[model samples]
Each structure stands twice: as structure tokens, then as C-alpha cells.
Target: MSEPETRVASPPPAASVKVLSGVWRGLGPIVYALVAGGVLLLLMGRDPIGFYATTIESGLLSQTGLEQSIIRMAPLLLMSAGLIVAFQAGLWNIGGDGQFLIAAAVVAGLGAPLVGVLPYSLALALLCVIGFVAGAAWTIVPSVLKAWYGVNEIITTLMVGFIGIRLANLLIKGPFLSDRSLVPQTDVIPFKYLLPYLPGTRIHLGIVVALAVLAAVHYMQTRTSYGLSLRMLGASPKAAAHAGLDVKRDIVTAFGLSGGLIGLAAAVEVLGVWGYVRADWNPAFGLTLFALVFLARLNVKLVIPLVGFFAVLSIGGHEAARRAGLPNDFLLLLIGLILFFMVFTEWARTKGWTAGMRLRAAGRTSQREAALDE
Candidate 1:
């Protein structure tokens, strides 16, 4: 038979099913949450179907409202993308709120002065770069401590947020306050300096910048060796070290880059929207962005859709509170409940009967022993 020599390679299994199935698994929790929200609305003496439909139509279906959604979505996307990197590197930067504030402070301090002196576009470019650098510097303190002294970053990052907030206040009220203004705000940047709007909407070029950042980060995460090293270091620092990776550099880079992006969000807010620094302009963007970051399940790409969804909720909740005679606090309570339920639902999925992964391992063990006994 002359050895009948020929070897055949089996065709690869289709990965589409796994990809679709994974997406469905992740979305199950969201579906359950919507169901729960409907039940709660019904219990609250409201028609769940009518109210919910109105909420969506009013907040996202209308042109004006949709524009508002995109306007707010820009910062959420930018900040959440950065947070995603920090999370992927096993670094918890809970101070994005503060980092964002300080970045705005930098832009306001620098951008306002350059308004008439430099070209508007040039000033904007400088503002973004300086804000990024400022954010990186702000984050370095914690990164150094985490990498060298084993300090807990959750605490350090959060505490720094207060400091950052204070710094913003000092600049807005003390240093930069305009003599002609009675309010706690700096002199407004010339109107020519604000970012141009997207056609038919209030959304600006900053949204484009934000989307670009998301795409860049997604590419790095999925395609680059640097990103792979980062993910590996995050998954298991000890293993990354065993593979001779630069653990310290990756950690610093991850945290610093995250801070820088978040800072840019603040700069976008100042230069693109507000036109000036105001002490009371943001009660707490850092906190809101952190919530979006968590809701995204720490996936950089998923964070974009999640931010949009949440922004819709913000607009709807604001309108419903004003028009429906519902308390704003009640809407907040509803949002909190939704977030809580989603988190619980996700936890439950991973801890189902016999726990999926644990059961698979046990089944494999049983089969191996049975074959051995045979």
C-alpha cells in the first residue's frame, strides 16, 4: 500500500457560536434588570409601559434630547475607556472624578489665557496635551506608591480626588475669578474658542475625539504586544514577572495612561462646552464616570454603549422628575436599584447550580477516574 502516506488537518471549529453565546450570556443580566425595572414601576403606581416608553422617546428619540445625550456621552466614554485600562492592569483608579476635575482646571488655567493670543485650534491642542500631562502627574503619586511601597490604590486614588476638587475650587474662586463676574467662575473663553458642533446636534468635536480614543484603546488591547503584556500583568502579576515582562513599567503606564485620558475628559468639558472654569460646574463627574466604568464590566469597548444607555437614563430621569411630579431622589433610588440588581444578576450567573466552571472540572475528574478504574 506504499505506506498510504498522507496526513489531514481537521477544519477549525466555528467560533461564531461561542462569540454569540458569550454576548448573550453577558446580556442576560441586562434583560433581567429591565424586567425588574418594569415590575418596580408597576408597583410605584405608574403604568410601566406608558411611562417607560415616554421616558425613552423623550430622552433619546427626539433630536434635541438626543443631542444632549451625545454631549454628555463624550466624557463618560473617555473616562470609562481610561478606567478600563486601569482595571485591566489590576489597578483601581477610583479617583477618576478628581482626576477629571483637575484636568479641567489645567485647561481653564491655560486655555483661557491663550484665547486671543494663539489660534483657537492651537490653544485647544495645547489644552488637551497639557491636561493629559497633568493627569499623568497626578496619577504618578499613587502609581509610585503602589509599585514601590505596596500602598492600597483604592484609598490613595479616592483621597486624591478630594485634593483635586479643592484645587479646582481654589482656581475658580480665588485665582481665576473675573472681576466683572459675580458668580464663582473664571472669565469666559471667547465664543470662537468653543468646539464646533456636529451638524444638527449640540454634540461637539470632543465626542469625535472620545470615539477616536476608544478605537485606539480597543486596537491596542486586541492587537498590540504592549496591550497583551498589560492584560497578562493584570491577570497574574507573578506570572508576568516569570515571563520577564516589565511589571513596574506596565503598571505605571496603565495607571498613568488611564489618568491622562480621564484628564482629557475634563479638558474637553472646559474648552468644548463650559468656555470657562466654574467652581460649581460639576458636583461630581468623577463619581458618575466611575459608575459607568463599573457598569461596563471593565471592557473598554462595551463601555461606550453602556455610557450611552446611562446617559439616556440621566435625561429621562431628569425629565420624568420635572414633568411627572416624581421626586428626583426617587429616580436616583431607581437607578441605584437597577445597578444593584444588574450586579447581583451577574454574580448569580457565575455562581449557578454546581457553579459552571467548578462542575466542568468535577465532571472531568470523575470521567478520568472511571477510565482509570476500567
Candidate 2:
């Protein structure tokens, strides 16, 4: 009888190992943050189990909760899409609130009139285009400064965003203010003129729009030449310029695309939910999503689940915080902890501290075995 052939497994490829390590590095901070949050909850005499249960039950298990969570996700998903583009291009559109407000104002101010004059479908299309243009136009100054003068986009975008918010407020209160209501808001589009609901669900077409936008973004990022250039620019602008890429044009285009997407998110929000743009109404999704996009490592595939998780947290965390006798901002603290831990872990990995600790642990194990043998 022939002897059975011996078989040995080969080690994973270096690339595979690196990918696994990267995933672990990305996810470890989330675990640590969650644990820390639980500990804090316990210290505050709150039941972490109950809090989590409420979050899950209310956010996912209940139909009403799920609808609300999904509704909230629409604009957030859109914002994430914009951030992905900006981050991948090595740009930051931190003024999403401003873009959102401005877009919403434009949509709200004109939506009702358009619906009255044109077909609903055509009106919706025109409003979205207007919103996108408004958002993109708002970034003109920042984009010009960064592309032409090498001014820091962070400062310019932020300042521009502040101005946008103030401008939107002024427009809503002054130019767009509706006489129908006492509230400082633009004229409302009736529910019939709003985005249609999905079949058998209260969720509107906005979620579909968001998903489609994300799909398009992923396709553009992975399968297009423009995406490659943007990635190169983000990795090193000097190198991209050296390679004969249009550095200035790319930077300007990136800012426009980023701002436009955020503006579309705002238009969707108005068309799907609010039907009007109110003064001082800012969901402030920009900052939270900055943390989230980093958490997902700017990978479009990861953004989906992370955004869903955030949407749930935003919706259910309110009830959970209330029940736990905590403030609404408690969720922000948890997100902040996650960001802190992610930064810390990356720093530790870069310093080889994690590898050193593993080496030390292995050495201790080997030494104990040697002692036993002796």
C-alpha cells in the first residue's frame, strides 16, 4: 500500500496578512471604545445591557424604529458619499452643514412654486439640479483659493461653511420666508409633492437616491481614471503634479463634487421629510461623518454598515440616553472615544509597540517552557 501523501499548509501571503492586520487595526479601536463606554455606563449606575438592548430593540427590531432609522440614514448616507469623495481626493468639505442648509433653502424656496407650475417629476429634477449647483457654487471661493493660491482648504472651507449657514438663515428669513406660517422657514411643499414612499414602506425615495449615489461613487472610485488621479493626488500632491496631472483643476473639481453631493443630501432631506427649510435647523452630520469615514478607513464598502450603525445610534441613542438619564450628546462622546482610540492604536502600530508587546509575550511563554524542561 502506498503511504499517504504528506501535506503541509503554506503560510498566508504577506499581502493577505497585511490586509488582515489592517482590518484588525481598524476594528480593534471600535471594540475598545465600546468596552470603555460600557464601563462608563456602569460607573454612572446605568445598565449597559439595558441600554444596548433598548438601542437594538428600538432601532432595529421595531418597525416604526426601523423606518425612522432608515429615514435618518438617507441624508447621512449622502453626506458620507460626499466625504468619501473629498477624503479620497485629499480634500475636506467640513462645511457640509452650510452646504446642506443652503441646498435645502434653495429647494424649499423654489420647490412649491415649481410643483405648482411644472410636472412633479420635472420639478423634482430641477430642484435637485438647483441644489447641487448651489452647493457646488458655495465652494467656489475655497476651491479657488486652494487650487490657485495654495491656501489651506481646512480654514477656507470652514469659514465658507459658516458663511453658508448664515447666508441660508438670511435667505430663509428674508427672501424665502413663507407667509403661511409664523416660523422662519421657506414655503412648504405639500406632502403630495414630496418624494414618493417606497412600496409597502414609509421610507421615501431618498434612501434609494442615497444608495444609488453610493454605488456610483464606489464605481467611480474603483473603476475610473479620475478616481486614480484623485487617489494619487491624495497620496501626494507633489507627486501627482510631477506626473503631469492637472493639480489645480483636480483640486477645484474635487471641492465642487464634494460640496455638490452634500447639497444634494440637503435637497433630499427637504424633499423627503421637512418639505421646508427652517432657520437654525442643522443636523450637523459633517463632523460626525468625519469620524465615521475615518473609522471605515475611507473604504466605500465599509461606509455602508458604519452609516447604518450610526443611523441606528442617532435614532435609538436618544431614547437610550433619556432612559439612562443621560444627555443627547452622550452618543457624540462615544464617537469621540472611538476616534481617539483609532488614532492611538494607529500611533502604537506605527511605533511597533504592539509588535514589541507580542514579542515580549512570546518570549515569556518560551522561557516558561524552557524552565519546565530543565
Candidate 3:
């Protein structure tokens, strides 16, 4: 009998190595930003080590600190989810702040009166629905304009957001104004309408709702045919149309979904945390949410952890600034530096400078080999 052929199995591809390399490359800019921030702190005569220690202790080590950090992440996660949908569809929904305010105003204006008149569950559900509808309505005009008329959504959405803010302020200062207070805010919702908190913690049910929405969004984006179409549309609208996708409808739907999510966040914030909406109490969290979404590279899965990190950064920064005797805006400077570095790194990757250098070196090597052969 012939000897059995022996074959050695090839080693598995080094996927783990590639993943680590990618992660390291992604974190390079952040590392650089931290170094630069530390240098700046030293120049300003601040103790970088002490600042970081205090930040960690206050933001993560304490029970109250941890609870507040999680509580703050809820709204940011909701807003980031909305942004991801719009961004994936190649739409920039810059009016998130406006959408948030309008939704909150709708919930406050209608929720107080309806809480007692209707069953508690039904009333709460209706309020959430109204908030969603209101948010979508605010974006419909801009969506239509962008889809059919090829108008610039950035300008239209931004301008409309200012209008929405003004409208919300008017509502609060007028019809929704509470009779019991001088502030420009709606009357508080009945106790039954407020969301219950976890035992011994300020963290409420809003985080649970936000997590549910995140899971649904992740499922849709990863497993559904609609998500594939959206990715194709974002990559190239003409190509998607050639592939028989309804590009306009997808774009419009993206805007609607984005606005609806922001509205839901507004409803959660009012019902779970504040139980009221005040004209002067704009959180202006839209920009921060935008930053967090971009920082996560638009991955829905990454948004959750990134938002939590952002909350920690925010809370810790405050503590650090207080301890260091720095202005409240000092942390903003660090954040800005990090963003600048991220942008620069992205530009470098797009330019492919390192790849070009490698190609040139390879060409030189081939020429040298040809010379030797001659």
C-alpha cells in the first residue's frame, strides 16, 4: 500500500492581529490628544496627575457618581441613535436640539391636562406618541425639500431648529406657563405620570427604554434588508437607484425616524427625570451627542459605551476643574483638542501618505532587482 499522504493544516488567518492593529490605529489620535492636553495642563501650572485622579474618583469610584453618570448617558444614547440613522442615510439632521425642545413642549403642554382625564397608561402612551409625531412633523418639510427639490438640508434643518426653539419658548411662556410659578415652564405632570426610579438611586426607567431602542436599532441595521438598502444609498444614491432602491423614500424615512427618536428622548427626559419642560432650561446636549456619535465612528453598538464615557468625562472634568481651580470651560478645550486631532488623523488616512511611501519604496526595490538581473 502507498504511504498515506500527510498534509499539515495551515495556521488560521491572523484576524485577531488585524483587529488589534485597527484598534491601535484608531486610538493613536486619542493618545496624542491626551499627551498634548497633559502638556498644556503642565504649562498652565495645573497638576495633571491629581486632576485625573480626582476625576476618576468622583466620576467612577463613588456610588452616587456612578449613578449620575449612568443617568446622564440615557438622553445622549437616545440622541446618538437618531443621529446614526440620519447619518447612515447621508442626511445631516442638525436640528436635533430643536426636535428635542419641540417634543418636550408637546409632552408638557398635553401631558398635564390628559394625565387625570385618561387612564394613566393610556395617557403616558399618548404623550409619547404625540412627542414622536411632533418631532417628525417638524422635520417633514426639510425632508421633503431635501428629497425632491435637492435643497441643502444642513441649512434648512438648522434654520428650522431655531424656529422650533422659538416656538417652544413661546409655548412655555404662554399657554403652558404654570400658574404656581414665575418661571416660563409648563405645570408639572401628575405624580402618576412620572417615571419610577430604581431603589436608592436617581437612575430611572428611561435608561431601560433607551437600551430597548438601541437593541431594536442594532437589529434593524444589522439584520434587515432595509438596512442594506440604506447603506447602499449612503454609499452612492445613483448606484442605489440603479439597483432598484427607492432612494427618495429612504431619505425621507430616515429623517422621520431620526426625528422620532429625538422626540422619544425628550419624552423620556421629561417624564422620567424632570416631569416638566422649562423655556430657559435648554440642555444643548445635541452637540455633545453629535460628538459622541462621531467619536464612536457611527456604530450603534459603540454609542452606548462612548456615551457612558462621555458622561464620565463631563462629570469628572467638572470635579477636576473645581479641584484645579481652572475655569469650567477648561475641559471644553481638551475636548476640542481631541476632536481636532481626530479630524487630522482622518484626513491623513484619506490621503494615504504612508501607503504612498510604501508603494514608492517597493518600486525602488523592483528597479534594483531588475538592475541586478541585467
TM-score of each: 0.84, 0.89, 0.86
Q: Write the per-residue lDDT of candidate 1 for residues 271-310, one digit (tens) a residue.
A: 7778887786664656656665666677776788778887
Q: In model 3, which regions exceed 4 Å deviation?
A: 1-13, 190-192, 350-374
Displacement of residue 44 (Cα, Å) in model 1 is 3.8
Question: What CA root-mean-square deviation does each model show from the true structure?
Answer: 6.3, 4.7, 6.0
Query: TM-score for model 2?
Result: 0.89
Candidate 3 on 57-174: residue-level lDDT in tens?
8888888788878887777788888899888878889999999999999898888898879987788778878887888888998999999998999999999999989999999988
Against the true structure, candidate 1 has what lDDT? Answer: 0.76
Q: Which 10 successive residues of model 1 have the least lDDT summed?
A: 4-13
The better-scoring model by TM-score among 1 and 3 is 3
Record all residue pairs in model 1 with backbone atoms less than 3 Å apart, i.e. clashing: 97-286
Residue 97, model 2: Cα distance from true site in angstroms: 1.4
Please give, for residues 1-374, the per-residue lDDT of candidate 2 as tens digits: 14323322432234444565666676777778878998999999999889888888888778998999999988898889988898898987788788888888888998888888999889998898899889888989999999999999889889989999999999999988999888788898999999999999999999999999999999998999999999999999999999999999999998889889999999899999989988988888889999999999899888888889888987888889888889988789889999999899889977878743454545555545544564
Clashing pairs in 2: none
lDDT, residue 349, model 1: 62
Please give the ranking of all candidate structures by TM-score, highest first, separated by commas: 2, 3, 1
